[model samples]
Target: MTDKDLRRAVLDELDFDPSLDAGDIGVAVSEGVVTLTGHVGSYAEKVEAERAVRRVRGVRAIAQEIAVRYADAKKVADDQIAARALAIIDWSVHLPKDAIQVTVSGGWITLTGAVPWRYQSRSAEAVVRQLSGVLGVTNRIAIEPRVPPGAVKDKILEAFRRSALFEADAIKVTVSGDRVILEGAVTARAERDAAERAAWSVPGVRAVEDRIVAMARADKMRCTAARIRDRSSIPETNARGTDPSGGRKDTKCSDRGACPVA
Candidate 1:
């Protein structure tokens, strides 16, 4: 599609989404890349606006320049945001109690401490980002690598083979200590995301370097756009996020609990 056409599509998608007020959001397209500017009322709405743009077909990449602006009456104190963040995290059954630490400054939350799984860290950020007055989240929750490097590689490859989104042979996985490096190319952006998610699901993956490229395919973009639109109507769920390869199982820890490995 031409840049002009893509720009219109993005604007329409943003306007169609009722969860966010798109009046202040600006859309600009060059080639297939989309750039979002201006500002929004909340961080969640800012995120929703970007997601709305991604739902449009022919959008290869997005440059998010949207700022979050809160009304004075709706502004929340940093200490309050911190307190609410801690309480919500403590309430989540998916996260180990007291395993994550919260720090808030200028309405942005910074998470520290350690967890046994990537999903726990991700869940912590997800829950906190939804709280009132949150500007952004910085998740520094480290993962405790429990399995050997070889087992990590094997588990990731097995996950890829089991998923319909990937051709296991097309992607290569390299394990160095607790870090994983993935290099390959897939046809759609979603596939590349799935590959990285699969690698992080492994037990010993402390970090992942995603080198997989998504080749531009008009047909795939159209299909993904349709799915995105369909999903936009569904109410958001708070369950632990699911990956394309079934889902990752949480590792069982000893009575003492999984401690952060220095």
Candidate 2:
């Protein structure tokens, strides 16, 4: 498809989603890359916007330049946001009690703690980003492995074998200490994501470096483009919260417990 057609498709996708206001959002396409610009009311909306663009066909990559802007009436103080974040996290059934700490500065929250599982660490961030006036979240939570590195590799490979999504032999797994590096190529982005998920599902994996690439076949590309066009006509339920920068490097927790507002 031409860049002009791709741009129109992206804009239509963004507008069709009920979860976000696409009034100020701009879409510019070159080749197959989509560049998003402008501002949104919340970080969640910004993320949803990007997701909408990705759903369109012919989108190879994205450059997210959308900014988060909170209205004055909805603006919340740092201390208030911190307190609310702490309360919500503590109340969550998925997270460990008192295992995560919250720190807020200028509407941004930083979570610091150590969890036995990657899901727990992600859960802590997911609950807090939905709070009012949260501009962004910096998840500094660390993962503590419970098994040997060798076993971790075996488990990850086993996971791939058990799943129908992966080719098993097509993907290569490299384990260094508790970190896993996945190197391979798949036909769709979902498969690459599945490989990463499989790697993280292992007991002793503390980190995952996904080097998998998605190379769509000619027929698959045509199907994907058709699917994008079809989906653009339908509306879906709204889900909240997102992070522009997918993940962060692990950092030592300097301020333990609930931190004071800065």
Candidate 3:
């Protein structure tokens, strides 16, 4: 559909009175993908607005470019990065407690958070991405940095210790300040997922940037990877997924199946 048609569709579907007026919401549509722009007060509001647009018929994908601006500049600097980060985490329904930290310097943003699951780290990223005026993000989040390197060797090792997802000693793990990088050849997709989960579990980590090369022994990687789920049940599913019969088209996957069914 045309961009105007998409904007009008989104505007019609969104019900909340955003902190800002409807005119402030910038809508861009190209090739059926809709992007929401402009500013809001809270990340939750920004998300609801996106949901509104996705509910409209003819929407294929959504790119949320909504910014969360502070009520006042005085509130910006006064809210320390760690404080702001924690507050964001505390306020978010999806983020976990005792898994994240915030570091800000002259406007630069650094997230130091950890979680047992790689998905949690990803959730933390999404949470911070909506913050207003986030200059740059230095993700120092790690997965399982608690284990001794001499003992664990790599993420695969740590994952084995915790979740039994992969070999304990097969994966290679390295830490450079806030970045925890993982590398190794694995036989299955679960092993890769385990490595990523371990990397994200470490405290004081910002980003578990992985560079591991997969060496699937059998077709397990191919078979298991297909079972990986994208969205979670914590956040309410976009009703757009289900048709009148509460059934959605099997082919209606996302750009990356990241938000399958809408």
Give the number of the best model, judged by lDDT.
Answer: 1
Backbone N/Cα/C clashes per model: 0, 0, 21
lDDT of each: 0.78, 0.77, 0.57
- Candidate 3 yields a Cα-based lDDT of 0.57
lDDT by residue for model 2 over 144-236, one digit each (tens)?
889888798889899999999768865778889999988755565567677888888776678898766555555344433333444454432
RMSD of each: 15.9, 16.4, 14.4
Q: Which stretches of candidate 2 lie over 4 Å from their true place?
A: 1-9, 54-58, 219-262
Worst 10 residues of 2 by lDDT: 253-262
Residue-level lDDT tens digits of model 1 in 77-190: 999999999999999999999899999999999999999999888899889988879999898999998897778888988999999977786677888889888875556556
Would you estimate the TM-scores of all the predictions? 0.77, 0.75, 0.40
Rank the models by lDDT, top first.
1, 2, 3
Error of 1 at 224 (Å): 22
Q: After superposition, how far is residue 8 of candidate 2 from its true place, in Å?
A: 4.1
Candidate 3 residue-wise lDDT, 115-166, digit = tens: 6545566677677656664544566776654455443345434455676656
TM-score for candidate 3, please give it: 0.40
